[model samples]
Target: MAPLASDPLGLAIDTTFDDTSVAILRGKREVLANLTLSQFKDHEEFGGVVPERASRKHLEAIQPLLAQALTRAGVGFGELDYVAVSTVPGLLGSILVGLTVAKSLAYLLARPLIGINHIEAHPYANVLAHGELPFPALHLVAAGGHTLLIHQTGHFQWSIVGRSVDDAAGECVDKVAKMFGHAMPGGPAVDRLALTHAPAAHRFPRPMLNDPGLDFSFSGLKTAVLYYRRDHGGDLEEGPVLSAFFDAVIEVLIVKTLRAARRFRPKAVTVSGGLAASQKLRAAFEAAAAEAGLRLLYPPPELCTDNAAMVACLAAHRYAAGRFDDLTLDGRPNLLD
Candidate 1:
């Protein structure tokens, strides 16, 4: 089905971490402009995002990005029907920057304000890109701060069935890359090296694969990598080590996600979050979904990472549902489902 030609416009702000982004969406189907300013260089020397530094950068970049989004969308402040911001499950300082800006916009423009859960907003990114999803879907969100398996029964109804007990998939990847002396935001670096390099004779352990429940545990897997590096004189080839590491992680993710799919028998299996951009993981999931005779869905690479477009898309749905937050809305760093 074709998406609507025009719908109410919404403005979204996202500063959950180092990425400062703003997006303008028309209803849930059309994205007019989505802009993100990465803080990789700012945090590269520190090896990861520092909360204070991330917040400072967000303050510097939010206004410009917001203007760009609105200008590119050809929409005025008064034209916006709602202002949305990601308000939970992120660095407190970073979340505050975006939320503050969004609140000011909402107040000045007299537009409805919506506070969105950063994690919940991720799966909806697929909906924005691909029209609509079949109901009763299973979604896997793998990112730096979260690893969750969710069951979506309707527009706003969600149930978390599984999640990580320790480090998230992206966090594990970054930690492994850092151990190998890779630069900050190591997930991409590790992914690139892993794809190009062949696996070594050694095989990394797949954590929690044989566990009875769907919960994940990657800390042990990460520790195993550290031990391997120490035992092997700490000079193994980057390609092979990373290749093996990614293999273990992807295998565990696929096995657990497929297990949940089998239990629930969902119409579709979806993967989102920063790590969901992994080519190897995506290939594995594609095969798993096919084997299970279920449809597979995911956002594009750009959408897989943190972006305000997804926030705006979810806000549109919330707006229609009459879900609005007052000026007292506050950032929630440890918010969970």
Candidate 2:
């Protein structure tokens, strides 16, 4: 890797509505400044995420957040060797805010434009903090919009081994949380309650565990939980039942991820994306990896969620490999490839 001395400086712009994070990477080191839209904490009164609300929030945060990242990196526009942006596989409006800004910057500065895939960037977020990803790596990305198991064959190369048949884990949690009047992004709130509540107190079915492949199905589980709530309607309130529901959700996530790891037989397993912040999932994956005798790697909780650091790290890898996308690159609405 000696000729790689001229490590391309990497810049990433993440306009994901949940958070607007920007990062600059030199070699593999991350220099970052991120901003979040706090409106959700206020809007949680509705008990779920509103897409339109998220879109507008991202638009307001994009420009100022980008400037902060540049300033913190202390790199002038002229010095940037690469400009990276996430163009697809995300909300259309939110995706446009970032692509437009990054595209314009790439054109103005005459730097190589690297359009990154949003889901692909999740695992590399771990690479940003941890040097390189282990080959045959299994990553469980649990975010609001996606729940997928990816096999990491090498840098920037992934084959989706399994995916959700219906709702993603995070989405299920959000919807279920709303059932109990929990706030937006119900994962955190549920996790907090789960800490004091025992998971074995109630029995919730683990979907797709009996089936083949690493694929997962949570829609049934969500509905099952709903039916449980309905059948037990007005059963004199709540102590153990609520605990059981939280436990059931955590179990489903842990079990499915473990199933993926067992099937992939990876050198290491990474749990990434927004829901990776969950303490229950973290503990569950760690314990499972230990029992399975596989290494488990995860980004710091804050980085585990959506961020630009992962994008920058991926860009750095692609840049070193002489891989660069042309300006003609378009944002893919379903840019999994």
Candidate 3:
């Protein structure tokens, strides 16, 4: 659908790390085109994102990705009412790449600039996927950099209930996969391996499972894998090893989330971020939801990862609420502040 004065159009940019992505979204929930150019190959050898390299790649790819997204969406710069960009809680250089582009577009086009929290926008992925969420929902965000449990009372109201004290679940997964000689962005690779074989005979530790508070820790678990691989050969079977690792992460996540659900009695339980794409995790959550008779909501795999569609989608709400940032907008390296 074409954007009009009533239903304003938005351009969303996300260069949080290894992906240079752009999307054209109409109004609140309608995504016209979302495109991403992954920098996986560039950072593959590093076994993790290198900030300088990620920034350089975003610069090289953002302009072309924007052009392609506009073309695919059948829209032009003149049609955009606002520019939305993820501005915080990521690599400083990488976030600046997108924020700069967004600032320039906002200044030239005389449109509102909306700076979005990458973590917060993740929960809205569920909103985009499942229409609107019922109020007071509990959301689990398991991404490359952050793992959090948020209690949402409304569109703009959120409180983090649980968070990773050490390594993020996805970060642990990537590091563990890197240990196995997998690529930089190894969540998908490890997930695929986990689906094939039974868990290793060595059962991994589920960190922070019995804690009274809803905090999480996966560093020990990841370290356990390191020690296991050290004692065993480097050529150990990967599928089973990854299976055990994935299970530990998933179990800690599921149990803690349900604990929060019980305490908060939220209307529903939702999943977000890249690691939310795991099939086994989804299956386990689905079973838990069924057994508890609680509603389970999550975005499709496409929206689960870091994408601009979710950025623009959340921006649409901020646009309506007149929550706009100025040209002085700067990237925040950590969301905690």
- lDDT leader: 3
> How would you encode candidate 3's per-residue C-alpha lDDT over 291-313 as one tens digit per residue?
98789999999999988899998
In candidate 3, stretches whose alpha carbon ends up further than 4 angstroms from where it belongs are 1-4, 39-55, 234-236
Instruction: Say which prediction, candidate 1 or candidate 3, comes out ahead on lDDT.
Output: 3
Residue pairs in candidate 2 whose N, alpha carbon or C atoms collide under 3 angstroms: none
Candidate 1 lDDT:
0.85
Ranking by lDDT: 3, 1, 2
lDDT of each: 0.85, 0.75, 0.87
Candidate 2: tens digits of C-alpha lDDT, residues 220-284: 87787788888878872443555576566667666777777777778988889888888876787
TM-score of each: 0.91, 0.88, 0.90
Residue 285 in model 2: lDDT: 71
Q: Model 2 Cα displacement at 31 (Å)? A: 2.9
Tens digit of lDDT per residue, candidate 1, span 1-337? 1222246689989888778889999877799988887623453433342334343488877766676677789988888888999998788998998999999999998878999988889998899878788989999999667899999898889988999999988899989899989876688887787788887779899988999789998999999999999998746787898898998999999899989988988898889999988887787789878887889999998999988899999999988777889999999889574
For model 2, the stretches where C-alpha displacement exceeds 4 angstroms are 1-5, 16-18, 37-54, 235-239, 335-337
| Model 1 misplaced regions, further than 4 Å | 1-6, 39-56
Q: For residue 284, what is the lDDT in candidate 3?
A: 85
